[model samples]
Target: MSQQAADEKLELLQHTMMNWWVQEHFDYPWRDSSEPDWKRLITEVLLQRTNAAAVKRLYVDFFFKYPTAESLASAPVEEVEQAIHSLGLRWRAQYLPGLASNIADGVPDSSDELMKLPGVGPYVTGAFMVLHRNTSSTFVDANVVRLLGRYLGFEWDGETRRKKWLLDHVDALFSHGYTPSEFGYALLDFSREVCGRAPQCQSCEARTQCAYFATLEANNRALAQDNS
Candidate 1:
């Protein structure tokens, strides 16, 4: 398809997905814009490879124990580790103190400054900017790559999220009238619910414009015809 056509299709897909999200989307404490910046940034770090449900269970208690970055920064490393021990990334405990130490005053608004802190990278930084700073920025994790790749009929290797072309398209998603937080929330929830590893393609509102669903339907038709 032509580039213009592809762009139009993506806009339509984003619109459809956002509309569905408005009807229903996952709720998480970290998604609340009113949350302290430190809490928001810390939640994103804990959520790295951990499940959102797990994060939800621990979130309130975690904040209660270490109410501010200064409290966490001053706490013993062992206690910090114990607090998040259930999250399964014990190694992250080491960085948590340092990350909190740097942000004890407050989380930085600049992406470059945020990246300078321990354990913060592009994904975390982008998420902080979009969700907390209200910036029109985009970021992708593996789930995002998988969801967008399948929808657009694109292939992704482990490094696809870093590619400029793909990143450009991801940025374009906002041009369709999606607020950064809304789009971020919608994309994350939609990826988990509808376009997951084993997607529920049949019921997906965006399936009609989805390349993966089209391919799935074509293969299914071929198999049925062969059986007949």
Candidate 2:
């Protein structure tokens, strides 16, 4: 497809996804914008490689015990590890305190400074900017990559170079007036609820524009005709 045509389709997809999200967005502690910046940061880290449901179960209690960076930084690493042991990231106990210590003074506003903190990577940095600062930035995590790759028909072979293309497409999709935090959360929820590894294209709001869904529909129709 031409760049102009692709851009138009992406814009439509974004609109459809955002509209769906307005009605169906998941409720989670991390999505609460009123939460402290440090708490959001910690939640984002906990969410890495861990399911949101698991983190949700522990979020309130975890924060209640270690409510501030100073408290988390001062707590014994073992206790912190035990607190999050259910999340299954053993290293987070150490990493969390280190991250707390790094940001003890204040959470950094710049991406570079945020990345300097322990366990903060490109995705975390991008998430922080969107959730904490409400800034426009493209951060592609696994779910976002899968959704975009299938939607845009980009072949993802797990190459680092593909991230730039994915990020660019994600950035373009958010050109509409949606806030970065809302758009990012919408994409994440959409990926999980509809456009998953085995996508439920029949119920997807963006199925009309999704390349993967088109192919799946075509294949299913062909199979039905053969059986008929």
Candidate 3:
């Protein structure tokens, strides 16, 4: 597709996806804006390399024990580790304290400042800014990368060079009128449910415009023709 045509299609896809997300939004504890910033950050950290459903199970008890940055900062690292041990992150215990200490004063609004915290990489920093500070920043995690790569028909070899390309396109996609937090969550849910590792393209709202789906359809047609 031409660049102009692709951009227009992406706009339509975003609109369709946003509407679907509003109707079928997943209710996660961390998505609650009423929750404390420290709690959200903690949950995000626990969510890394861990199943979100599993993190949701431990969220309430985990926050009740360490509700604030100061509280988590003061807690013994071993105890912190124990609380999240089920998340399969043995080293997260060590990282949590430093993150808490950095945010003990206040959560930073800027990405640079946020990145200074332990475990506050690009994805976390972008998430924190959008969720906690209501800021516009581009942060691409594995899920976002995969979803966008397929949707946009970009062939990425999983190299650092491709990250910039992914982030740039993601930033453009989010540049539409969608609120950062809502759009972020929509992307998360869509990636998990519709556009997963093995995407459910048949039921996808944007399948008509999805580059990956087009490729799949073409391949299936070619295979059927060969068999005939």
Pairs that collide in candidate 3 are: none
Question: Among all windows of ten consecutive residues in candidate 2, which has the lowest summed lDDT?
Answer: 158-167
Task: Assess candidate 1 and give its TM-score to the true structure.
Answer: 0.92
Using TM-score as the measure, the top candidate is: 1
The TM-score of candidate 3 is: 0.89
Q: What is the lDDT of candidate 1?
A: 0.84
Task: Sort by lDDT, best first.
Answer: 1, 2, 3
TM-scores for all predictions: 0.92, 0.89, 0.89
lDDT (10s digit) by residue, model 2, range 48-120: 7677889999998999999888999888999999999999977878889888878777788999989988989
Candidate 1 residues 121-213, lDDT tens each?
Answer: 898998888877878877788888898788889999898989988887777665656687788788778877778779988878778888999
lDDT of each: 0.84, 0.81, 0.78
lDDT per residue, candidate 3, 72-130, as tens digits?
88889899989888888678899898888887766776788878888877777877777
- Between prediction 1 and prediction 2, the one with superior lDDT is 1
Report the CA-based lDDT of candidate 3 relative to the real structure: 0.78
